[model samples]
Structures are given as C-alpha cells and as structure tokens.
Target chain A: MEDVEAQTHLIGDSGEDPIISKIALAEVQRAIDSLPQEQREVLALVCGEDLTYREAAEVLNVPIGTVMSRLARARRRLVEMTAAA
Target chain B: MSELHLTDEILMAFADGELDQPVAAAVARVMAQDPAVARKIVEFQQSRRLTRSVFANNLAPDVPSELRAAISAKIEAYEAAVEGGEGKQAKETKSIWGGGMSPVRMALAASLAAVAVSAAYFIGQHSQSEVGRLAQLEHPRVLQELSRLESGRDAELPFGRLRVISTYRLPDNSLCREFRLQSTSTSTDAVACRTDGWRVTFALSDPAKGAEYVPSSGGDLLESYLDNLGAGNPLEGEAEAKALSETAR
Candidate 1:
C-alpha cells in the first residue's frame, strides 16, 4: 500500500514536479501537484529495478543516448532544485 | 579525469550501474583516483535516491489489488490467445480490453502491456547473448527444464546452465526445488516452488565459482529455509522422477 501510486499508474510525464526537498512531504507533494498530468505518466516503470541504458530506452521509446542525456539532465536538475530549496 | 574525458552520459550511466563490466570498471578506476569525478558520480546516485524517497512518501494508502488483478488477467488472456493460434485472435483480444474504455483505463492498459514487453525483451536479450550467463529465469525452456530436471544432473541451455540440487514436498504437499544457476561471472543458489509458474522463494548470488560443483561451504542459508519448510528427505530415483513428472502436469 505504501507504494500503490508507484505500482498502479506509472502515468508520469504530465509535467508534475517530483520534488524531494529536505523540508517536508507537504511541500514536496505541493510541488508534485504543480507538475503536468503527463510527467508522472511518462515511464517511471523502471524505477527500483536495475535496467540497462538500452533497456530503459526501449521502455521509454527513446534512443539509448536520449536515455543517458535525460538521466544526466534530470539528475543535475534534481540536484539544483533541491540545493536551492 | 581530463585524459579519460568521461562524458556526462557515460558518467550518468555508470552512476546508474548500467554500464557494461569493462566500461564500468574503467570509470571506477578513474573515480578512485579523482575526488571531483567521484563526487559527480555520487551526485547522480543521490538524485536517484531522493526521487525514490519521494515516491515512497506519496504512495497511495490502499494497494491497487484490483488494478493488479485486471492487468494480470489481461496478460493471461493475451498469452492464452497467442497460444491458442491465429484464428481466434480477434475474438479474444477485443472483448477483454478493447471496448469503450476510459482514457485512464487506456493508459493503465498500455502501461501493463509495456511491462509485459519489458519481460519479452529480457527473454529476447537472453536468447541472443546469454547462453553462458545466468541472469534471469525468463526463458520458457528454462522453466520447462526446471519442471523435470533431476537432482545431481544439470542441463546446459543456450540461455545458461541450471542444476537442481534437490526437491522437496512441503507439509501442505507443494513441490519445491533447490537449484543453482551458473554463469561465467557468478553463480546463484535459489529455491523455486511449483505454482502457476516456478516462483522463486529464495535466491543468493555467489561469486563466479566455475561450473563444477563446489562442495557446500558449510555455512549455507537455503538449507535452513528448507528445514523450516519441514522438508524431511529429498526424493531420489523413482521417487524423484515421479515427483517431477507430477509437477510438470
């Protein structure tokens, strides 16, 4: 039940900000509420599982390099966003 | 670091532990020598951790057992149709999932299909390049073999080799097997029970110790799990064959 949302609807990519600022769940959830409906829908299917870059690309229907690039960009963005918080 | 000239993509992939053995090894050497490079890798790991933590926090209170059941039923139906042959395809595929479905239902259905595709992809990958490596129990041939393989003898398949060390019948009469999966880089000892499928109940990865039977190290863990299952004695010869034959049915 703890990860029911993570399990059922992987409907990310609706532009929702999956924030994890150190402040609190309330604030972090507020950020998630602000994200687009599809951001969360965009393939978070591979989370918690060990997927190769090629595997992740196939899951997302993106190129392998595109997978790496998004991973790079998303990780950096997460760092900056949390740092600023 | 400058000489290695590692790209962000490479670094990110390495941080994700997705790089192949050789490339990931190279990245590790560089990280060991350079603090800045190491920090960059750590940053990527931290970001991933944070994201997962947020997901853990926001999980819905109730398990979506209904959704899981629907998705599983759809998959079973699809597999049944595929196995039943080509003539009845349109009939079974349409009624189960293809009516006037809502947009949300459509997305859920699509995502569920994607998960199945991911499994197919694992098997597809195994068939082409994994004969010597025991990565996953995804191949049907492997499952079929598990159903009949006797203890002591092992089978070498294109996907990998599997050895059934022993078989057991629980107090409730369910059949279970203790087996090992061997590859070039590692070997895994596991226990799987007969159900709708061979469900893995326990697994432990061991360092690559060649294909030859390494005598038990005496500190085995799976032995105890079997002990708890009330497995009295391992079946052998006619008894073993009978147990396995019955399970395959």
Candidate 2:
C-alpha cells in the first residue's frame, strides 16, 4: 500500500487539485487492500487484467454467476468504503 | 424500465460492459433521465480505474530469473517429448504451466506469448500500409470500402484482403457488419454498423499468427460485447445477402 501512495502522485486527470487527487487515490487503494482475499482477487482479475466475467470465471475456476455475484459484492463494498472516506 | 427499478447487478454489468445492446441502450436511456443512476455508473467506472491503478503500481520490474529458467526448461521438455512421440508429457507440461501457475504468473506468461506472436509478425514485414488503413477507421474512403465489401464487393486493396464475417441487425433495427482485414504483418477483426454511416463498435488487431489470421467469432471480449448488445447469430448466405441488399437502400 505504500507503493500505492508513492504512485498516486503520478495519476492525473481526476479534475481535482493534484494533491487532493493523490490523497483520494491513496485512500481508494487502502480501501481495496482492506477487502477480503477472494473479493480482492476477483476485483484484480476483472478490473486489472481486463478479463471478461466468463474469462475471469475460467481463471478463478468458478461459475459465471459466482463471478458476477462476487464482483457485485466487491464493487458495492468499494463504493461504501469510498463514501465513508 | 425506470431508473429506480435498475438493479445493482444490471448497473454493474453495464459498467463492466456485460449487458447486451438493447438492455445497455435501455440503461443509457434511463441514465439520461436519472442523475442518481448516472452518478452510480460513474462511480463504478472510477472504482474500476482506481483498482487497476493500484495493481499497476504493484507490477514487478522484471520477471524472476528462476521463473524464466522454469519456462525455458518446460519448453525444452515439451520439444523433447514431441520428438519422442510422448504427447501425454507435452500436454501435462502445458497444464502445469497454465493451470497450476498463480494468476500473476499466468498473466506474465500470456504477455510472453503475445510478445512472441508480435515478434514473429513484425520481423522484416512491412506493416505501415495495413496499420495505416486500420487507423483510418473514420475516413470516408475506408467506410466506403467497408460498405462495398459488406455489399459483396470482392476487390483487394493494396493493404491486403477484406471480407465480411457476419452481419446482424441491432435491436434498434440498425444493420451492423463484422469484417476481417488480413495483411502480411497484421490481421484485424472489426464490427461496423450503418447508422448515419458506418460506425465501428469494436475492433481488435493481432500480429499475423500464421499464414492467415482469422479471429475467432466467439472471442471473449467480442462475445461479451455482442452479448451486451443483444446481438444474435451473424447473417450468412442468403440472410447475409438479404441484409446487404437492405443496407444498400
């Protein structure tokens, strides 16, 4: 997560002031890291690698519906985390 | 459907590009009418971007030397097994490398495969002409050429060969055509539909993997996109001919 804080300085285009964007990005990274391992894995595979849900299911060895449910839960959790932040 | 009626699953699918066309369009229409739904969609997209950024920050600068050695040894073993007619061993080795590996390791391996494919295609091959044409997707001439091919024109351009792979009508009753462009160095698969003119909905390019490159019609991304759009089986033979004739008008 320290690496995330360091890298956030380079993330632009958020329309917020540069310092504010970096802080927001760092907070989001912390929120993601706090997720359960399974949720984090699903989120990483789909969002990070650009895999479709079916492809992510194949990789995670789960059913497609499971992938959808996990992803939905993971996303919902992130929204809640960010809103609280 | 009302914006208030939209479910989390549906909104997530739309953000992830999982919804079919009509459903996606309906979502879009609702978003236009509902600020809350639109804001949620934006939040979903931002979350995805943030998640990806975090992972991107974590990527190792280099592959571990031991992993490289393992890959090389595996390849050598695969070759030896092939020579010895031990097909089972080769299959076992592939499974061990592909299925048994960690997700990050698997992604690294996939990138290596893509690099190999790209290297094979780009070496000593002239790609400018083909790549240039593909980059001109919005040009009037390119659209005209696409339209001609969709309507059964079989003329070859200097860039390479072009042919329609499939044609389908969207829920809006608009006609779309999936086509392939094969050149010496690269191959592209694209979908364009007749709106005010031909508008490209999707396009993917790969280095020439063999003597010819034919993108699988059921490629994961394309399949997901088609599923979201509620696209049906591609028109073929007489159906394709009929769709082409209709588009001509």
Highest TM-score: give the candidate number: 2
Worst 10 residues of 2 chain B by lDDT: B105-114
What interface RMSD, in Å and to 1 decimal, does model 1 have? 14.1
Give per-residue CA lDDT, model 1, range B1-249, as digits (tens).
245569876766665555555566556545534556665665555454444434444421222456435443544554465577832223222211122221111111112112111112222222323322333653576678778788988999764588878988876687878888776755667667675677654444552122111123312445644554466689789988998888766
Q: Which stretches of candidate 1 lie over 4 Å from their true place?
A: A1-43, A48-50, B1-3, B59-249
User: How accurate locally is residue B211 in candidate 1, as Cα lDDT from 0 to 100?
Assistant: 16
TM-score of chain A of each: 0.48, 0.75
Off by over 4 Å in 2: A1-85, B1-101, B104-134, B150-154, B207-218
Model 2 chain A worst lDDT window (10 residues): A7-16
Candidate 2, residue B51: how far the Cα is off, in Å: 3.7
TM-score list, all predictions: 0.35, 0.43
The digit string of per-residue lDDT tens for model 2 on B1-249 reads 544458877777777667665677677545534556665665565566566555555531233456435544544555575569954212222212223322221111222112111211222123464336446544565566665554444446666667666677777787777777666766666667686678655555652222111222224444544544556777667776676666567
True-structure Cα RMSD, model 2:
12.7
